[model samples]
Target: MSEEFPIQPKFGPFLRLFLHSQLFCTPQLPTQSFADQTVIITGANVGLGLEAARHFYRLNCARLIIAVRTVSKGQTAKEDILQTVKHRNEADAIEVWDLDLTSTASTVAFAERVNKELPRVDVLVQNAGINSKTYAVSEGIEQTMQVNVSNTFLLALLLLPKLTETAKSAKSLPHLTIVTSEAHHLAKFPQINTPDIFESLNDEKFYNGQSSYEISKLMQILFVREFVSRINAKNPPSPSVIVNLVNPGLCFSTLATRNEKPLAARIIGSIIYKIIGRTTEVGSRTLVLGASAGPTSHGEYMSDGQNQDVESWIYTDVGIRAQKKVFEQTMKVLESRKPGLGYAVGL
Candidate 1:
């Protein structure tokens, strides 16, 4: 690696990206089998998460867990998969579990359930996140930051033991993949200069709906880098848990255009989606790729089908400063949710 970051993204503009999408293609669907792997995917009721779960089940993953906010929606997603894909073992092959990222209590309970019921977890796809234009709060925090960044990592860390244990017992490199976006590079991160990123983010007076999602995505990437550094902090790592962040690119997803957006915004978004977005099915392939990635991908960013260097800005002086600040502040907030979680997760 050179002093400069590798492969700084060249097509950062919308027009260039749209033209690129027009010329290139989504990730070629993975035909690799996931046999014997117990895979868990968040927000699997629809969109990328649901389609990703479908691929795993189609590839003959032994056990599939569709973690969702509502069990009913998950059931619907499961039934859709069963009807479309031919399954050999019919009953209990797929389990639906409740996971509400908006609430710390819910996040904690969900992890506890996984620890209690699941024999092992080979892959965890953190595909559930929000991109809304509305200002809302959950559990006394801004909803977007809570779901997309805070609780998301909390769930991952809470389940670290399960992932590492499965790695050792199954002789596999378990994966913990977080679904992020290319828009992270566009984040102004209005809170970066503040003494506390999370605290500043909580100041509703300064909250921006548009940049909030981008900031959260950026935070996810930053946090993953910091988290991996700690995961193997002491020297020899515990059982290998390949942690990765993936960008599915802009895709046609109903989740993002739901009531959380105004009609005008939704209409404009729909037009943009039709012009340049890949289908949810196509986008999900990237998630599957990220989840199946090997040890070399640890602490790396995966896009389309392979590891890509993050934007050069992320390696710049400004970006490095922002990264360190966000990680330190994030840990302080997360520690309250799970005391000594850094140590618990082998930090």
Candidate 2:
């Protein structure tokens, strides 16, 4: 039987719960024996994305594409996975592709490649995202917003056709899993505004550190809920595909720390993390759960491998309402942009 926690966690330190809980038995989860399914995992070079890829590979999923920004690093990750999984052949299983979600051009190129070559993509995990030390701009938008929100939005839109096609052909189902964060619980709401814009590259105000990180995470959840609603409205009962969001419980893996402070500062942080963070294996469990076939709540947020039936009073309604508005705005932005791009910028 699947495990259940009697004590639901609070939003601020949900990662703490994620790090500390053994929410489910990995061995008992569904296997890839289901008809060959193709899954695309972003940010697969390391951290949660890499771990998630390994999970899919073990299930013997048809084709697991590692869509990463660093193509070379991605290749190395592919090698590592092959080595880690016993008796696994390199071909007919895992592949790598270049995808820098921060750039509209790159997002487009990646989508085009997938649309042209792959027959059907069963899962598109929007796992690639970033946070910078100082403020920066990507594709003319705030760096965090661009990578975490806009680019993600664009990629989801571009991949919709393939997702739709796969949903129709397979007769089973397709899913879009987004790697969101518990930090979203802190966001005042999901409405995108001028203040929400990253002021400038290296803007210290934005980088006081924790605040910016939390804000980006908040946007991520909003994006997930927003996308789900749109998919339902546009596609209807055929539903074809479903979108779900997850906050991989805080394991001590680098989300944006790869670009963080001085070596000493990073080391100190790592030490602190060692004291609190979960292993990569533990942190990625919920993400893997989100991607798998299950009863995923449409237009809802999930944490610790299960849906949060009752949210904190402060966040309960705002999170939902804000996500709805943000979804509408995101569609308008995507609808207005030129076709053939993975992400559209300029607000």
Candidate 3:
């Protein structure tokens, strides 16, 4: 199975991408019952993740696990979500679990715990992410790349077994929703040509004036494409899980207002957000839609609750080659962290 999407006309596509900023109806789901599914949403303490979790609860998801770096904050968000959501049963459950994305040990531990305890992982939403303004390293990799690119996909790979297990036993297509963003369109990814993209990104000079976060997001897009291909190539009678990347459009994000950036840029961003940015609740519906989106949406990029094409260049041979490199290197790093992960995950 080739991972390449048909390239669209570069000039024609943007005019159609209304983004969440200009206008979009609140995504409404028909009354659906997730009365027996276990849904896990990371970064559920605040922002889009929190809102997405609330929507799943509203849909009557039987067991919800709100994974957060801070348990206290997760508890607060859990309470807020539980307040008005109608329940399926008094025995229905929502629990706050600890998951620190910044640490490899923590991420592995979280997934291990999930595999051990969770009866099923009906949907795994990879919502937790970071936008680091200054240069920093975690686990010897640049901090932003460490969490967003390396660890994020690591957790995804580690959890694949349980997800596939849920699929087989439940006879349901489990969802693995990885959060991406429109900011990837801004990523030139100048370091992609380097002998080692991840290593080049570690140089403080490369990140000094460059958009490290945006580049990381581009890596995410590439990673998903290649990952879907490898899994589908396994030649199962049918896919056990649906995996896709989602762009929530430009949400009114505090990360947009980081202090290290230019003053004029921040001012302009604040103005734009006021004029057009989406609220976390409105933005989060994409996550909900992505998780529920069926077979056709597998490996697609979802925007505004529908399958949307990515940047036109991504379908080109150059882009296809880059996609392979990113996923290969990402898998290399992840495997170094946890030997044999790629084969073990059926990738």
Candidate 4:
């Protein structure tokens, strides 16, 4: 494992971030209207994703696609957002699309629908993820690794063509924001020493559910870095699609307490969240900012509504090797699902 940072996963930085968010991290509402823009947010049925939908709606975005696993649940979220809108006519702007991250076919279908139906995609937020409390497998891989890492990028890569297409004709640069977490710093790099990190991580003997979640987030940052590099190298410079990652910091949400956590633990976590965690609305501000931020945020990891340095561990020699290895494995998995996807995205 790489040497731990003095500030990350420690009391000082955590406290500082908490205090800053409470006192200074106010949501910066967009001055420019999203009058004709199409915004798609996955896992938008609840939590920060739902709150982000509300923010986009407030900006009068033309098409707000709430992509969730359950169509009924998405409809409910859409209705909830419509209820909050001051004018009834604006309610028509919100639409629900079914997206199940665990299934590659479902993700492909969702992308196809978006390409055929939506005239353009101004923003795509990859926010659907879970921190599974127990070991489980989905689509023949560990659930956390499958949903948070592989499937997350699978969806992103599938949608790249649409984003690039939109940027070709649109006035504003298109944005693809991946919601990550500060927990990424907690990943133990030694666990991923093998050439095939994804397959190694799947071994039950070495499996640690929480650690897997952290590693998945860490991989997300690395993937964004490598992905942006590839796009920048494309001939003729593919339209200015800003690919960035955002950490919402500690937030008061049910993300961790899901999947049969003990009652006492849930109570303790709830109390801590109430005391120190930002509300979902406040935390979603960072997501909103990333989705709307300009060129400066490209390929950046943002926290507390600003660009923050990625942990030094990601820059180490070992870390760079891990990034390339994981990227290759990621491409293998994604390409197996949709043949020729990497070339389509100029990878």
C-alpha RMSD of each candidate structure in angstroms: 3.9, 6.9, 3.9, 2.9
lDDT per residue for candidate 3 within 81-184, as digits (tens), equals 87756553333488989999889999999999998999889999999988877889898889999889999999998998898889887746899999998777
lDDT of each residue in 266-332, candidate 2, tens digit only: 8887886776666776767677777764645555566666775323532555445655555655555
After superposition, candidate 2 runs with Cα above 4 Å error: 1-35, 188-209, 233-238, 262-268, 309-317, 339-347
Model 3 error, position 192 (Å): 1.1
The local lDDT score (0 to 100) that residue 305 gets in candidate 3 is 75
Q: Is candidate 1 or candidate 4 better by lDDT?
A: 1
TM-scores of the candidates are: 0.92, 0.81, 0.90, 0.92
Which 10 consecutive positions of candidate 3 have the poorest summed lDDT?
3-12
- Tens digits of per-residue lDDT for model 1, 1-347: 34221223344563465357444957989888888999999999999999999999998889999999999999999999888887554647899999999999999999999999899999999999988777888876789999999999999999988998998777568999999987776676656766667777878787787688888998999888877776566657543788999989888886566646667877898887887788899999999998888777899888886887676667777566666777888888789889998788777
Model 1, residue 27: displacement in angstroms?
Answer: 0.2
Query: Which regions of candidate 1 deviate over 4 angstroms?
Result: 1-22, 87-89, 237-239, 260-264
Clashing pairs in 2: 108-342, 135-201, 135-202, 184-218
Clashes of 2: 4
